[model samples]
Target: MASDTNELFPIPAYCKTIVGSEDGTIEDSPLQKLEISNPARILQLCEGLTDRTTKKLEIKINKYLQAETDASSVFMINLLTVSEEAMVQVVGDNILETSIRTPLSEDTISDIVEYKDNSLKCAEKLDPKLQTLINEIVTKDTGDLNIVPIVAKERRANIPKKTIVSPVYLVCFVNSSKDNRYITTLVHETFKYCLALLLNTRECEEERRLKQQCQSLLAVARKLFSHLGDLNDLLKEIMSEARRLTNAERCSLFLLDPDHMHLVAKVFDGMSPAEKNTEVRIAKDQGIAGHVAATGTILNIKNAYKHPLFYKGIDEATGFKTRNILCFPIRDEDTIVGVAQLCNKMDGHFDYFDEQVANAFSIYCGISIMHSLVYKRIQDAQARSQLSNELMMYHMQVSDQDVADVVTCPNSHDLPNFESFSFVPRRVFHRETPCFVLEMFERLDLIDHFRIKRDTLARFILYARKGYRDVPYHNWQHAFSVAHFAFLCLRNFQLVEKGYLSKLEALAYLISCLCHDIDHRGTTNAFQQQSNSVLASLYSSEGSVMERHHLSQTICTLNTEGCNFLESLSREDYIKCLDLIKNMILATDLAIHYKLHSRQLAMAQEGFTRSNPEHRYYLCSLLMTCADLSDQTKDWPETKKVAQLIYTEFFMQGDLERKMGKQPVDMMNREKASIPDHQLEFLTECCICIFRILSTIFPSAKTLVDSITRNIIAWESSKNVFDKLRVEGCTSYDVLISEELERQVQATLECMQDP
Candidate 1:
């Protein structure tokens, strides 16, 4: 029997089994007795019983006992007789009991049972009594059977109470044998161990399911946010996603209109297109959504109609019933941008878990709406830019007659000494500058080399002239003067011979010069940024607002009808020419001159070569800058005339700035401007440095440097005369530049001349 116990039962090495005496007195089994008395001690002993141990016990019992048995014999009777007569009598009896006690505590079991019963009644569409008594016979704490009454109360009652009873047993067996009691304890311990294993398995499964749900929600949100569409479509998708996430029948998205202190319903699901498009605005202080948006608080109302803050007007207007609502604030950073409202959850009512999911979804909603708004704004800006370009083309259109007039004009090869420092463009062109520009193109034979039409060149030139605004300094006249200087440089500097510029490069440079100052507002880049003008917003990051605007206008003009002069060039030449044109025009911005001039000067010292594209472009930019500021390199009379015109444009901007409640800079304010002093500073800092750098690369330009030096001397002499007049109480610029002083300045300039 001892060998059979070791082989069949296989009790663990750590466990000791006690055999009761026939007389029912086992004095040496203290631990066994304690386990019988304390159910918790039984749990500790049963902790080590794995599935292998339980199976072994089951096999051993099945070998000794009958396979079929009554509940009383299996659960209550504790002793099994191994005699042949007892075995033959109970052979085919089922030994394993079908009934088992749950592992939950008595109070927890009572709560669950009551909830189950109420749920079943609700499912059956039956209203159970408010208080119902369920009588049950259960084992007491002392292991004694007792009759207890359990009462089930209303589920939603504020103070609903339940009376709990321990688990009930259906059958019982009376046995005075101590061996039977010990066997009963062993069977109960095994049952407790199995129950604990089942509970742990269930808990693990539930945790895994919850994790999967969270991951699924996040994946859905990622897919929704990845959608790039207009704002209205994005809003509709967001509302649809919100409804899906919360299992809500309907959803609406309300945007906070801070400007008007209103919460506007921007998107509402479960509505026709016409109804959704209807604008519905509610005060920020009213309605559940309004409250959430204003306070940035989440509201999960189980019964929205019962809440005082719930506004019923929306439901009435939409012809829909509102039962429950989950309203969450949509926040961008710390600011509440909007609100998302979900109504009538499919599952009885919204719970805390629904609130959590809605809150998470709202975060994605806020980000998506922000991106959509930005996308819409970009589309609107693009539309406006296209419209502006169309308007520009419309007003600046060059008629065929205008083109024919300029193209048919008699071409003259003896135009003027356009490269001379004393040459005056206003007198040389004789107010027919467009015709002279066409003659220059004809002289260069550009029309035949590029296969360009005479009408196209004429139209482009005329359109470019018209592109310049009526500003005093940066107007059509200034544009023509710059283009003229570029032409003179290309013609006389032997640029092609020195490998500095090709004919194509000269054409791009001249065109870039003509279009460099188009549509000038007479205000500086600093003024544009300070005022936050539209041009500033568009081009401030590139650091040359007006220059970029000029480039844009140039492209728009070239795209106009009959103005695309480069259309006949090969694809490669067209692309290269356009790139050179863009670079040259942008280079005219004085803000970048110091860097470009320094780079070119260093390259020139290293023996500049046009083979390197970078070095060639640097020289091109340098030439464009010099042409832009060519007024400072002219004779004294031409220099003074250009200076007065520039100062007039500056003073006009200064007066406008004052009207706009901004203080003008010292150079712009007419009251503070000293003409001779300003001219001296510009000559020393800007004009002289430019020409000096150019002379290093092209020694032929040294004459232009000498011309700028002589002009500087004239400005110095004029400053001295002005200082003397100021000391003599002449306050006005007109009084300071008296006839005597002018004649003196002229005499000094004549003496300093190259002749």
Candidate 2:
């Protein structure tokens, strides 16, 4: 039987059996031969036919009857009238009497009663279980209501008395209570049943709709993933999709505060031109939307004003009305990732349908929010990396060698123009190790230069004499490497080349490296004034503290050497290498970034001017800077050491500044070590700078540069992660690397020095 209700319509299923024919085939219908079926006779047939069996009879009656009634209602007439009239013709006049007057036997009645009694007993036993099963099936669907079957009992005169009675279910109205108004009960049950059927259909449709939405979302996700590079675009896509799915007239997404208790709106749709900068903030527990957000649940309000939790103050301030709201908390697992609100549903009211739609969307919202957040982070990180690299390249460009390519010496260019300059015969400087030059300076008379050698340069030399134990390649090693590498360039130019070796040239390169750190201090340019370092006053901020130190150190190394490299060189060669080394060492300060960039551009314009002594000096200066940053291109173990050394130098400087009540320099002033990932990121940029510069000046070194770059990437792969709370973790620079370990390292060096 088809159930009918206001909100839902049920379509009838075909009945399995015919009403009267024993064969249950329409060809055997008695009504086929019926001549005049009077209205009264039709009414009788209608009453005789089971109300539950209509679709089949309709088909049968439509075949045999020519009635004024609609084809569907034509089957409502009495079946007996059709049967009797047709039977009378076949069996003579006796059929009428037999059909009308035949009495049912008591035994037959008794058997019917017995069967009914047994059926009722079993049905009664199954009803509760059946209801339970129905409830289970509908529990997940919010629209489902409890539906109970209608059961009736029948008794016959010949039936034997029994404990159980036969019960028949009419499958009529779902009754809320025994006293439910009969008409309303019928309506409610029929309506409820119809709704259940409709719901099944609706669910199928809804699933299809949701599946399509998911496909769309997945497509958007795939597109955004491809733009892994453009995070801003990715975030924009996510916000746009959120608005589209909610059918919201306007929507906005907020970033959670670091504390996670409040939300700060970051992006929006449907904002007035004037409201672009407007901030919307709500507490975790504030309104219908906020409650859903706070509890990580869905909140649907058909009428926002009627809800106790709805606050109108925000609407008043923002000039946006809240009519209907569908909100769901965006969650990544048990953690609430964010809260999303779809306000003023385009349909004007939030319903069960809205809930289903929103619930489906919430899943995408949560994932999209997570994905977008990650995308933005990666974008920010990459931008920072690019900027750092650009700066490093800029520095490489301005090295001393770079300057020589553009600007000739004040008077040296006029000294001599030979077919080929008589290049100096070279002597190897610091044969055992580059640090030997510092020891050689131990015998210099620094008093002539108005300096106390023992207090300054000699102290530095003494420190280096403590011995080299493979300290990681950090700033200190970078400085030492630069010194050694400068020597290599000088030796290569002077000794390796045919007729290239020159005494003057060798002195120029060796002395340049030796005096590179004469007045060295363990701080950056910014800290010089704050710590009242002597170099700060001496240089008067004309140049970086480190650069000033390098020049001073070179001048002092001169007072000690038996033959000054400066005196040995021709005036032209002397000025060229001197200018070259000065600019190269200065590039290490990182403060002269603009200067470095300008010089590199000049070098580029000059093309391959390596054969020019001045140009060779320019290139040599650049090579030294490269060596200083070489750790960035080193193997993991070597790079790790450099990171440690750089960190230590930064911390030592930061400590001094902090003690003096100044801001700590860069990342070092913090009270913890920096995360390895960030450190590795820093190294990666450094590598790019080295590789880029080498590609330009010393293309032969590309293989070596590439190896270092590979190691940095590998180190990043095995990075160490630290909790924000763990103070000792390597996410900051101030974290101490155990005093005992430092002492042991120093002790090891002392033993080596004694032997």
Candidate 3:
């Protein structure tokens, strides 16, 4: 049976001579020599061969030289050597040897490579002889053997066509004895390995492609943020970049509503604006995008329809069918703000590659959006600063002159006793009146109303020096301007006898203006109320933020300092002062703005006509109101500054209202046209109102009013110019209060020194 099989397995050309070496000997039967050019050729030959011949070839090659033979037989042994199987053993052994490894050093390399394949690990046992052999083999550059394994598989593939050639290929490295099972596998096992290799190669290519796409997406996202002007531009750029990188049919971005629990589709592509109008809503954990957002993780869906949570409503509405989705959450550091999703990938269904790309995209989007928000905040803060500076110059200009002059008063006697007033308490007797009033005025800086007759003369200098650090609009400067205006109005009222001053009314106007906005935080009353801040809680949210706390702080500071101003007052006068202060401070609230303006207008229409106490009292109240908004009569820079502060307060209130889930009033609505227009309209009204009031009260104010009117008109002309043109809009930080404004606002200490 063996002889018949040998005849049936025709001897290959290279094997014929080796079989002829010995006569009539079983070993003389040509030890099948399978010679191939390379490892790849081995795969081809294995495909054509049968199962049984491959085994016989392995046995014949092994017996060619059972022990060291003559040099004459060297060619026979080399030709018959089917060592392709050894390459597999080498690879397998290498995997194991390196698997249980230490660092690769010169000493370790030799032992690791040349060690015998006895199936024993380094931990089990050590053969000194085998270890020594391994050292020498690794150290020496044994030529040909290093290149020997490349041909091993080839030789196995080249067996004679007559023999039942198996698919298995034997591979061996000539130099090392580390791997002994050269060609051990049958054809079936080889096929399995090839399949696995194909799968692994495909995965590697996919991983590389995914990484490249991710890198590209990130680059585009960063560029978009640096130039984004508003939320609309931001969303558009995001959508464009996402589609570009993913090569998808469509891409969408959804932001978490301010409540932060639901996703609202803010931007999308391949959809009409009308359809996109109603933002898509989903729970944080709802769909693939929502799931990613809720968990702040990457989500990969191979089939959208297969997903239980893939809301089909989106498909029906957009008339777009989605098969696969790659979604990732956009996070601002640790907080998930929104999610991004890509649909209908251009290539094969979205997989791990798409997931990786989406993740990278999300990172860039998150970082850029955060930077834009911060930039916007900085711009707002800068605008507020400039506004404060303008107010400062206006305040200083008015404070330096005589308040009686600016308001156009005819009398010189009742003008505040500027020459006799002393800020310091020189004697115990002086502390009760002059000393006390001076001290409050110094802290508040209310001396500005007396100086500037020109409508261009601004007030509110304290705000410029202090800026928006501790307080918002209500600061030392605002308090001072209010007091000065109040005092002048008080004197004018008494002169006209529109109302009576018993000592109480005089002191009350002074006190109220000084303390109205003390300890302000440059934010808003609503902020205090919404935050339920300690100030709000302590005052019981009973009135506006500053107005509510003004009285309490004034009383506390007065009591703590133990000023004697009230000691001389009769009970009636003291009560009257308290009442006046409370009423004036409460009037600062915008909620009562219309009423206050109407009453002031009514008094102005009454004319500087009557010389009675009742008429004088009405004039006093009217003048106080004028002083509150006197910024309009200030110089260009100062007036603009005051206006800016008021605007900031308004915008900040809008922001707070939005955050608290309340609808914004007027320009505060979450729409584009509402903000700047609202600001301009209100400011224009104020300019007209202030101009009219000043014209009525101070006849000399005509030139000042004309100048102010020109500036106001100039602002209207540009639509971009600030009431004061430092750089134009508060947004332009390049321009600031002119050097002249700065110098004018820095009042001479000499004037304040006496009172």
lDDT of each: 0.67, 0.45, 0.49
Output the worst ten-in-a-row residue range by lDDT, candidate 2: 85-94
- For model 2, residues 1-755, the per-residue Cα lDDT tens digits are 23443213332233122243342212323333322223333443344444233233333333323122212111111111111110010111111122111112323222333222122332244334233433432343333122222222333455556332321221211112221122213222232223233334434655676788778767766765665544345545656665676666766565555475776664556666566555667676776556766676787666778889977886897788888777776666557766666678664445444566566655665565666667666754564456335434532222333223222323322112111112111112222332233322322222232232323333333333222223232223444454545444444333324333234444444445544544355556667766655556445435676576666545444433332424534578667766655765665655553345446546745664646665555454555555555445444444545556667767777677777777763577556445455566665655466456656654555655665655555444433213322435443432223333334434543454594
Give the better candidate number (1 or 3) by lDDT.
1
The predicted structure with the larger TM-score, 1 or 3, is 1
Query: What's the distance in Å from true for residue 341, model 2?
Result: 66
lDDT of 1 by residue, 1-755 (tens): 33553233434443645555674433444343334433333343345434333223333333322111112222221111111000011111333332111122233333333322122221133112111111111222323221111122223334357533322211122121233435344433334344344334434554674687688678867776677555666778888877877789998888888889998884578888888767789888787888887788898787888999987887898799999888899987668888888899885666555676777777887877787768757865885486477557656567788888888876563655765645667565534889888776766567788888888888988888888777778988888888878877877887765668887898898889889988888989989998888777667645888898899889988988878999988899999998998899889888788767678778878878878988888889889989998878777777777777888888888898999999898788877778788878888988888888888887888988888888888888887777777778774355333676678899887786647
Q: Cα lDDT of model 3 overall? A: 0.49
| 1 versus 2: better lDDT goes to | 1
* Number of backbone-clashing residue pairs for each candidate, in the order shown: 6, 41, 44
Which residue segments of model 1 deviate by more than 4 Å? 1-396, 411-413, 419-421, 725-741, 751-755
Angstrom error of the Cα, residue 617, model 1: value is 1.4
